[model samples]
Target: MSIDSQKGAGLPAQGTPPVVPPSAPHSAVEKQVARSYNSAVANETLEDYSLRYAPKSFRRWSEYTVATTALGGIAYLADFAIGASIAISHGFENALASVLVAALVIFLTGIPISYYSARYNIDMDLLTRAAGFGYLGSTLTSIVYASFTFIFFALEGSIMAQAFHLGFGLPLWIGYAVASLIVIPIVIFGMTAMAKLQVWTQPVWLTLMFAPFVFVAIKDPHSYAAFTHWSGGTDVKGGSTFSAVGFGAGMGVALSLIAQIGEQVDYLRFMPDKTAANAKKWWTAVLAAGPGWVVLGAFKQIGGAFLAFLIVASAGTVVADEPIEQFRHGLGVYITAGTLGVAVFFVVLSQIKINVVNAYSGSLSWSNFFSRLLHYHPGRVVWIFFNIGIALTLMEANVFSFLNTVLGFYSNVAIAWIGAIVADLVINKPLGLSPSIVEFKRAHLYNFNPVGFVSMLIGSAVSIVAFEWGFGHGTFGTYAQAFSPFIALALAFVLSPVFAVLTKGKYYIAREDTLPEPLTVDGQLSGVSMECGVCTDHFERPDMAYCPFHSSAICSLCCSLDKACHDMCKKGGASSGPVDLTLTRASS
Candidate 1:
């Protein structure tokens, strides 16, 4: 008998191979199957590279190099701008407390996310899919993650445009276009190109960034004390008493950065396999640069806060609110030669490095979202433009004025997703509530899981209510904002274990015995290879798979996007329980 007919012996098949069944009950699985097929067809170099499984051969870089390259993207000047803006608006005391609280939270949350990505070599999309979101549920979070990348891309690109307008007298429109287009070619090559670009730019960027601060410290020692006492815009009520609500709101805005761990993990996935010799460096790099990004970010924010205070004291209220204006005034204290030109040049250069990263990460996010939802991936290159196009539109519409509103609104959604994922990774995995290793492939995952989905929905709903209710409005409207991220994290942590107990971990892995290949000392799958049915290319054991619908072994990428099969081959036999029931009826 044909392999297809043999596999379908229990069920009646009118025509065609049993593996690729002619008909089946319609469900979300049908859509998933179609998407998987389409993604397989587009598995060219330009489209859907390394989707289903990460081949060991492709992971060639040293852990340190990968970590450094990833961390370099975080070297954004906008931290300073954000810090300065918050301080000038909220006063020194509030901004300082907010910065401290936000930094601590971001750093702590980043630890588990970074470790898993590095250990498993999977991006956040894959990570979320396995964590608890299930196959289709993760797709929803992918859209949310993509939104974070592009929104930041637009914000960073806008900053670049402003710098261009200041430095070269270019129109903001032209500057925005220039900023968006420049990153496309670099991103086309993906991680390879980004590493070189970030490495080369790091030194010059660091030098320019630190020179002004050093000069300020050496020349005007007395300015430091003035920074602490100066109140730029915040109104003090009843003797400088701390307001929990005001502090919470400011912290929420600053803590919106929690999603940035996704970008960091994208790079960490490239880290070399851990070994006795490389383990020290591997752990060091991961910790130092992984969640450690907040260290630098916090410092920059504080510096921005200090600079804003200095500007208020010197240039008065109008320019104090603008970070660029504040920086220009401060840098002038040091540079006697062409001070205006030097300051503008430094600002422009700093913004370009950061905006490029924003655009690049955004493209990856968009690519993941559309490829899964629409069942077609033109290429990563195509999405780069698609992402940029959105950002460009936002810029033209003058999004800068609405920055706080947009970020505040976005934080609720972003935090919910991040917190849910973190809860699963840190709390669930360790406590035996979820699978230890990430199970990202569609063939190996359920369509939906209640753990992350329920947690995020509940957390976001509550936080939104608190925000709208104005609980912290008495201190500063921003105080009510802090509730979202914490609520999401806390609820997800509590709910994941409960969900695991109820579901009994059946959804964590489809069939554990299916993964029979032996792993190397460092967890690398070994000693087997199979050819993809769609691409007809051979892959290592980890990248190869058997599909019951097609009645053949295929590569992981092919299985991921195959839309035709309807998942006829699952654990033990056919796709669904009804099919097996039908077979028993026929036999009787």
Candidate 2:
């Protein structure tokens, strides 16, 4: 959390210890080292493509490129739809205020979370593992994180389906299939392919997005004032009354977006290695494009609210209620002619841009879940279909009709998971209650850690209760619902430190002493390159390592998938000794 603490720690000096060769005696210690090495270093396309290790070689892209790619995912038109829905239901003033509050909280928590993931070359799953969730503890959170991706994928796909219905008169079933299928090919190659797709599409997406607003303002200056004065659809006067409990509950629903930082961190982990030459750009890009996503999101929400008001004023009561209808009306007001065609074109373009990100992130999440749970990774490409299949089922079931109920219930769990992660990254590490470096390998982590698990459990339980009960139903109820996100945030932040202290930081790192020292020249760490055992290709020093299990120096990607070792080296066992010695000892 503090740069001052990280700086000035010179690399291990020369002769401090010779590089431990992979040929070390086949003792329990050597076996443990081998398991750790193998677990952390395995398949580049599959492991690094999802949730395992992040090697220096993969972090070759510049910070701007990385950040831009990550932020590009936020171009989804859903923000506008969500903002407009909230405005119509809750009133414009209330929606605007709530959105601002949510953005601020997301930004503050995102700073530490984003920075750590990029700096450590770890994704959210791995970061959670080292931050006190332990190995298995974080697995539960991975399921939660994975659910966030798929749920949003369905939502984004549903929006695109609407566009298909409008533009081509396609049945919803066909539209869902089309929307889901198009993204699979784009995501099959992972970040390499996604980066190019995002870069190429972003400029046009942005231009189309704001062009209507510019036209609206230029043609009728009075419309802006009319929008500001709009009272809204709800009968309850002047927005819901301010109450701690009500505010908390409403904010909790909005704050479910905290999990989005996980997706952003996915790209950020690809940021170029932070050397002295690139530190400034790295920090700036990461901070701006990482957590800074909330800023643009907040604006979109407010813009949606404004557009919704305009639609209601111009089109009629019925049209204002439907998001597609609202957008159609807004386009009509701006376009001179071909209003229907322009509206359909804008909707399809926006939906495609956002849906690709949704499908892409979901595939990564599904990949992480199946690989760890089933121990069989078909490939990142396979998971894309798996994720889309889930979304297609949701569409068939007509999930959109219950969007409010679904999102509200989902927010509780989503906030809890994100809250625990942010707390560990921001509070535990700074207080020295957790390890400075992230330890993600199965061999170097306990199956469960209480710090993150307990925090998430507590936060979720309280928020769900507050949401279900009308504790803030009266004058105070509105405020409670609106501020629930802060409640979850506070609870997780406080609990993480408390739990870490209670546990005495024992679970933070499973095997500290066993980790190999950094490759160094003189007193400073100098970059060295080595070949990956699996791919038979060269990688940077941080990516290449010696593994004693297969008795070869393997890459991080190969280590993730080499289940043959059976984690024998991680813990002292019969397999830790040489084959001949173990057989002779057993017979004796």
Candidate 3:
């Protein structure tokens, strides 16, 4: 909790050249190799504090605005498609049970994560780093979270492309390009542009999304009654009866979206600090925009199921799950004159709203992943193109063709990763087994923490085995394949605490915080700013850590990029002796 002034004894004064130690090579130690980011990365407006803590100084939006913007990003049609697909495979009875179960699980798990990210002002990557996965250890979860963004991005883009094909007579290839390219201009500006875009279009999107359903109720009242008895297709076993295996299969596909909370927290990180005066509004906003997203998402899935049931006989089951097709037939029930145009417009808007968020969150995760590995960061804007390009490639390859298979297989890994993090945040921290406060800086965290990282690995490995080969090959295999996601979640949750106790929580923090300034003031992250000795840029207090090697305060970005330091400040490098790796109880 106190600064180690003795470590800077032999170190030269700030802004002065230090005496080169004879024990090390002189060439590499002569100059401070600090990282310099471009204007896009340096400025909070363009970068939105990507790859670092979202300081209080930059989190200026009101709770209502932040909540709306976060919820706006969830305006995707994929839920409808996912719901329709699950129903098609598992019949109405099983699909209904599965969807509700998945939604409940997602909502409960999302609560702790959302609260932490909003309170701490850090993205999912930083949260993971401190929540059991260490600095380098979080790199694994970063890739897992990044994959979620792009896979969904491609799926949403493919849906948008279908709209283009339906309305403009564009070929699927050209439509794919259009869908991928449209979000670039908007996403280039980061949260500033995205907030405006989402807020302005939300009303219109909502109107179009629900208009068809309202009209169908008035025009075809009997359709709703008939849909209740729709026992999937002839392919489904046992007609409309529910089956345990079928429910589990549906849950696996629905649970693939466990990582969607990462996207929610990507925005939740910007939530203004909650004060007593705004406590009511703060909790409401966080819950609604965070876990509350699944409420609407579940409804959309059911709505998609209803719409697909209406048009399956006419359009065939193959295209029933496509969002563009679902909306086309739904809107056609009332707006006969320009149904295609309206449906295409709605699809394009929904895709753009959600894809920008997908692209934005992807850039953040990729930035975190590459920064730790390469020790270099050009800018966050650069990664937007990289994320979109990958999604575009997937679209070109027609990734939408194998949606169920891809999502089902992916759910195992996603659930395991998220489950481990949730266990750390909810169980380990509260039980005084791990650090209560999220310590995300590279200076304090170990390279790897077995508590969450190994638990996630074990959970993912076992669940993937269950999903692919299924325990053995008989009835066990069938049940295992159907319930692999549940297995992954349970193992990760149980193992996180077990590993924390086994490791004695020593791996959680490499060294105690040595910054001179307090991390917070009056129960809130301090707005006091400090200048980075290496980067020569001013950053907020939470982002700055004392660097014994440089004999000055350094920003986290500069600390992360300083290759020559070798973390001497924490490890007792050239100037300081190795610090004790003791387990300390962090403040609640």
Candidate 4:
């Protein structure tokens, strides 16, 4: 055929649909290979991106706009309660010093994590998996991260319950249940609606939070002077003598917020793609919404400490750590008739803002957890209710009464998890011990990797032992008592490189999966859609892998959930019998 005739024949006829070959990257073979699996096809919504990547197309919001919405969640007044409680238990100097140290560590660690998540568009779970912890190894962090969410959820819920009791004479039990359940609908829509909720309430929450502080400062400057010298008299250390032991204990509680970086990056993952044109805007948003949470958090903690002292000065009592009581008494000094009303409104608003973020993040954590452990996929929405149920139970168990002990204990594990991750990213990757880029697909990773998993395990065990003083009665016990978090972080950081060297970084990549046929279009964004054969749904290019078991392309979620494949797509993976997913759900 002549060249002109070939060109005319190659093009689709006028007004006729173009023919897409089944062998092409975006073939029309999506729903043809395997049986329909579960409700994953039905669950797609504004839940942003759960158990999947946030593609370029889904990232429609500007960097600054998303940052503003994400930053607003930090207005949770639990910082007020936690700051007051620690300052009362351990002196002002110890608590303040501890807060500064913890904030510094959290900010430094958050930077690499935030950059990777925004640049690659993955959540903490996927980041952990690709960093050094293997596919199943990262599930341990998933459970730990999930626990952080619910623990904070329960703590924030208790604050809201107290607000309810003070405002409406509601019973504490009923208030706890109400506070726990009210966030379900708000978070069900995920970032889209949740972002709006936080943005709209930011103005009201900021006004109310600062109003009492400004009012108190202007009305009675003497209270500030009184606040400086008020030492919470304790049986240990004899009233704020700046003991090393006190600083360590206080720091243990403060460092629990380190894991909160996970929740922040969940939103940052949806940030619009950074380009040469918007590079400055992107970095500003990442820092402000990422590590900047703690900058504001540290300030609020100091504010809370001062507020507690003001309550002590005015009310002649040092027991004002409870948020409802602190706000009630602080506002009472200036407002005449409706002080309780104003205090209750601010407290409730603050709790709602933080709890929504907590609940939403918890749901994501739970989804990662169950999806891995059970090998049966349920929608993220189902896990939202499960997470709330656990938090509600924790609230009823009275987590607030023992907040210091709980957070101090949790801080050890939280920091250890973060330390291992940070060490892997900063130390191992650049040293040529591990892969340079993140490979998160299940087909590309081992079931578990010892580099991160073993490091976190040993770190947690050593820290917990020190927390309980497993060291014999000697200089070691004294050191352990004052350096628990420091000990855990140092151990994890040091051990990660050692483990990486020992393992030779062999477990980082399972298979290269060099496909015979391309899984992506030649010239398009990674968001170009490819259909999953099993689920009968389209997913972004990165999320779709060519499945040898099904002999077609399938989404990564379906691949991860496929027990029948038994990782047969990878080397030495033999095919197994298919799992009855419905029966698995029923038995559970």
1 or 2, greater by TM-score: 1
lDDT of 3 by residue, 1-588 (tens): 212322222122333222233243443453346546778887778788887789876788899889999999999999999999888777788888889999999999999999999998999999999888999999999889989999999999999999898888999999999999999999989889998998899999899989989989989988877776668863322347789999999999999888999999999999998899999999999999999999999899888888888777777789999988888888888876988888888999999999999999999999899889888788888889999999999999999989989899899999998899999988887786886767788876778998899999999999999999998989989999899999999999999999988876777766655555666777788777776766767778778776666655667887787687676655532222222212111222
Q: Which candidate number would show the highest lDDT if scored against the true structure?
A: 3
Q: What are the per-residue Cα lDDT tens digits for candidate 1 across 1-588?
A: 111122222122333222344343443444244223244235443332435455566777887678778877886666776676666656667778988988998898889888887877778888888888887788888778777777777777777777778778889899888877877776666777778877887888778777767878989878777677645553222233355655666666677677888888877877886668888999998887789989888988888777776666556654454546656767777878777677777666666566666666666676666656665556566777887898888888767656656766677777888778888887777676776656677665667877887777787777776666645566444544555556655666677767776776556555332333333323444524555544556565555555545434456556656666555555332232122222111110
lDDT for each of the candidates?
0.67, 0.66, 0.84, 0.77
> What is candidate 4's lDDT per residue for 1-588, written digit by digit as tens?
211122222111232222222343323343345556445435556345688888766777888768977887787877887788778877677878888998999999999899888877889999999877899999999999999999999999998998899799999999999998888888888888878888788888888888778888878878666555545643222345576777888888889999999999988988887778888999999999999999989988878877877665444333477778888877877888899989998888888898888888888888887778787656777788888899999999999889888998888898999999999889987786776666678866788888899999999889998987747578779779567887889999899989888888877766554432222233222555666667666667667666656656667788778776566555542222322333211110
Q: Which stretches of candidate 3 lie over 4 Å from their true place?
A: 1-35, 234-239, 572-588
Candidate with maximal TM-score: 3
Can you tell me which runs of candidate 4 are displaced by over 4 Å? 1-41, 233-240, 313-319, 513-525, 572-588
* RMSD (Å) of each candidate, 1 decimal: 7.8, 6.9, 6.0, 9.4
Where model 1 places Cα greater than 4 Å from the true spot, the runs are: 1-50, 234-241, 313-323, 471-482, 513-516, 519-522, 525-529, 570-588
What is the Cα-based lDDT of residue 469 in candidate 1?
64
Between candidates 1 and 3, the one scoring higher on lDDT is 3
Model 2, span 118-151: residue lDDT tens: 8766688878877778766877887787777777
TM-score per prediction, in order, is 0.85, 0.83, 0.92, 0.88
